[model samples]
Target: MANRTRTPNEGLARLLKQAKWSRSQFALVINRMGAEAGLGLRYDQSAVSHWVGGTVPNPPVRRLIVEAFSRKLHRTVTHAEAGLPLAAFDQAPPGVDTVEGIVDLGRADMDPSRRGVMAAAGLFSAGLAVPVFSAPAHATEASPVTPGKQTVRIGAGQVEAVRRMTDKIADILDELGGAHARPMAAAFLVNTVVPWLRAEASDTVKKDMWATAADLVYLTGWMAMYERDHGTAQDYYVKALKLAGRAEDHVTYCRTLRGMSLQASNLGYGPLALKLADSAAEAAPKAGPRLQAFLMGQQAHANSMVGDHRRARSLLAETEAALMKADNRRESIGGYNQSAYAFHVSHVLHEGKDLPGSISALQQALKVMPSNERQGRVHFYAVLAQRQLEYGHLEAACESWARFLEDYEHISSARGDEHFDTMRLRLKPFRKAQAVRQLSPRIADVALLKA
Candidate 1:
């Protein structure tokens, strides 16, 4: 049956219906399975339309559909039972059999609700199986263009093989995020994935490709933004948005916009940040709870950036309320929580003349953040120092600033340096005083920080 030719989306549709899933949820499940198989493909209502219109997936993807149902229903699926064509063996991409698209493709699956879908023991099991590129060649079955006499037909088997390639790419990207990972990741995105997405591919493959592209674009932009390339970061964000839109993914869209808003607010574009945040919040009401929470949190950050203390507070309170009402499965949308949100707002309050609030918020944020992230720790410390400085706690300010430098030396992350640099500038008047003068050696090495 795996080698027979058949069109089986209706069979899939029927099976999903029995599970009481809405069309959207079914699409989400399908998209997630593809992502889990490591294809990084996403689906929305538009994808459902394509499926209903006979846009049958290649054999490899069809197998993924079968697998999704099998797992969900706790039953095995036969190619024939799924209504897939027997001759679909040749319908997949070459070397696509393995699920490598899981890198970016599995991202959406990170949602809390899907956590139980795969067992912890199986986490790295897939990574170990397959020849890494065990997929076959001649697998362009997922291609959108019709095959002609001269163009050989792509079989389901061949299409399944291409999964190996995307999986390899995902692995490579993951490995490159270390000490020297940033530049390499950037090169991979610019010189490779971007070109692939722009090239000709099947709609199925294109959807898969674009989701991967969005992930890479966002990562590159984030690293570059940290390096202070605001313009480049904005370009990446724009590209990511376009790709995410093509994939019809709302969560990635929200994430890209919120990430950009953070940069804007930090760079003094408070008005722009506010606008972006407002738009995000408005669009979020229709999304998943996690996505909505994420958008709301960003909006809170934007309001605080602009010194809208009252507005920020109100939004945060609303965010907290929303979060409290949300199921545990939805928490993944806004990852860290109101702790990070509150901390950010507190910094704004401190900067805007609310000293007591800032100190209190900083203290709270530090409690929740991981101790070893280094960079975030420094920012929290710097904010604490600033609040102390503002309140005329000269000795305490000096103590906090000294501790900030300890974490600063362990990592070259720019955000940490920027915060410390700001503290240095603010502490200038007190420089010649006895306590500050004693730390002259530490102050002399300002090269690592922003001036």
Candidate 2:
């Protein structure tokens, strides 16, 4: 018998070299990431050697490997880059019904065993497609319940319950942060909302129920996004879109799309954000003034991100005009106020490279923000401090950071934690400054508590 030669995976080998991690070290890091994703993987150096020696990993396993490298290198590493097989998520497939998908996604979000993989490794796709608003009724309708499936009969009161619960969750989110509110939302979906969806009801009542559920789910997804759980957030957003579409609830549908746009913009997907934002606006051509302001503000941010300064400025002007025309009825789900409007103005100015103007706008946002919105204040303070530092205003930055720490101590949030870490790093090089000295002891105390 003749001897055969095996081709090595040059791409993986190249990445391993760039990473400067020994095979064993690489295996350990990947194992830790897998545990976070709920995949109790136990690969050692030998397993890694095999992959580098041209052995292909399964798709899920491949993504795990890619995520590990992406985290290590602080950049995205695709399947092809690692010489692995392509995954189905590259082109998302659609098949599940509205109610069934909601139940499945909500259950996964609620359980640690399932959510470990889902939330910890939440996927953010730059290639996702938004559902068209004008799809035929038959195309977007919920599938008929199978015979023998246990179901209940629901009414308008049940729909109102869902709506009220959603508002309460939003309040908790603003006060205590998503860490405290998301689980409540997940429980509500699985226990209360799912039953209502499966229940028998008049057509009008059913539509109302679906629209209400969609609002709650959209809110849940928004909280996930705030927590930096992108994959879980994306899943919830998609389900909300379907639920809204099935009910022909154009307002909820547009609101959901606007939420998606905000997520995209935050993650630096400028074009996708713009596309989703435009879709949101176009879908509801006759939207009320507040909704118009809500959608246009995001569109302006996306435009600024994409370097359309002229268009972004134009959009900002229109957003202000529409906001002025809107009545005092603050929408619970898709609310837009002067604070939110000013926040968008700050975003546009910052993205347009007008730092001084942006800082001024941010100050206005903070000034008008509701006193009860402490969680939002935590985020705003951190940003203001960082930007103040950037603009060489050391004392002002320290004052802003002091405010951040005050609210930060009371909140339980992954993002707030991240901001705390960043605050420490930013202050490290300025230890000799008087402002920095005054802030150090409090910083140490907070660090101990957070630890």
Candidate 3:
């Protein structure tokens, strides 16, 4: 049952009038829009009447109503304008402190039922207001602490341990895939990291811990992103921002923003991605060439997608120049390398409609990619095969797909699974080709293993 008030929903009634929609008309629109999103809503005039008669819709239904009105009015609409309540996750920010919010969000994410509700609650916000990185340093003790939980004293050693664990998790993500990595990260955040954040430590140690925790949370969010649980991913990203802000760690803060930019680019929000990338670059320190390359590479990809190819090409050149000056060591948070640069080049070229150029870049990426990065190899080969097939190089595509299948079979990744399915579907028509014919038995063995 929906929570209710004795008074009518004057705000919704006003919007309905402004949209020139009758109760039945509004209900029909709501049901139709809900169906489009896979929700089986069958609301009618009476249900609309109840909503106007002081009953608030469920959280998902509230979003549906907002979407319905937004469509009818041809403008953005807000819950405040509709007189609807914000969902719990949405309410967490502004009203809650950073540490408490992180703990709460992590705990809910850890629970199966709560996580399902969060996933269904529409946690992904395209229009979410991202915080500026100019956050002033705040005292660590300002965060609300959990009562009755025992606090442990932490030092530089504890901070180093988190960094080591984060590196280990990164290795696992690269070697095995996020399916084998993210759970460990989440458990460490909830079981080990959070307590240290809430522990007895010198102010300097506490800030270090917060910054370290932010990096871990950011990685967790990145994994959630590749796993396609975008809503959950956004939750982790927001917590990462808060933690970064609390520690005044601009490096991690900008890195998180860059991560958000990549997520936006992946979701086809080109303009949004560019805005986020620009924000990261603007606030980023002159850390080193590696950091510059990392930021510029994303900016290049985003600009390319938005048809600003001139700017994109310049950024790409700058990225390559900067990367050349940097050391070969992985630069921690989502390290940028020749392989990553080559992949970015592929994205830029593909967006420019240069299919052959894109294929060549993907090949370069594969050639330079570290052999231990099985997870990345799976995606690289899958995309390379797809482009090769699209470019009418059937035999070359078959060879690439064979490579994809090899790395894919050894990894446990949701995206790798998707590509596996796509490879089979894409090859079905080419079964008569000699290369594909030769690859058939291998494909079947991998498919059966996956199944």
Error at 346, model 1, angstroms: 0.8
Q: Please provide, for model 2 over 37-150, each residue's C-alpha lDDT reduced to its tens digit, 9 standing for 90 to 100.
A: 677889899999999998887655675676567556754454556776555533322222445456556666675446457765558887877666645354223433322332
How far out, in Å, is residue 350 in model 2?
0.8
450: Cα error in model 1, Å: 12
lDDT of each: 0.57, 0.82, 0.82
Models 1 onward score TM values of 0.56, 0.77, 0.77
Point out the higher-scoring one by lDDT: 1 or 3.
3
Model 1 clash tally, residue pairs: 48
RMSD per candidate (Å) reads 18.9, 12.6, 13.2
Separate clash counts for every candidate: 48, 2, 0
lDDT by residue for model 3 (1-451), tens: 9955478899899999999999999988888777776788889999999988879888778867765775567544556668777557553223134554455556655554354576676457899998665456555553333223333688999999999999999999988888778778877887788667757787788788888999999998898788777888888888888788878898898899999999999899999999999999998876689889999999999999999989999999999999999998874576889999999999999999999999999999999998888998999999999999999999999999888888888887878988988988999998898998999999999989988
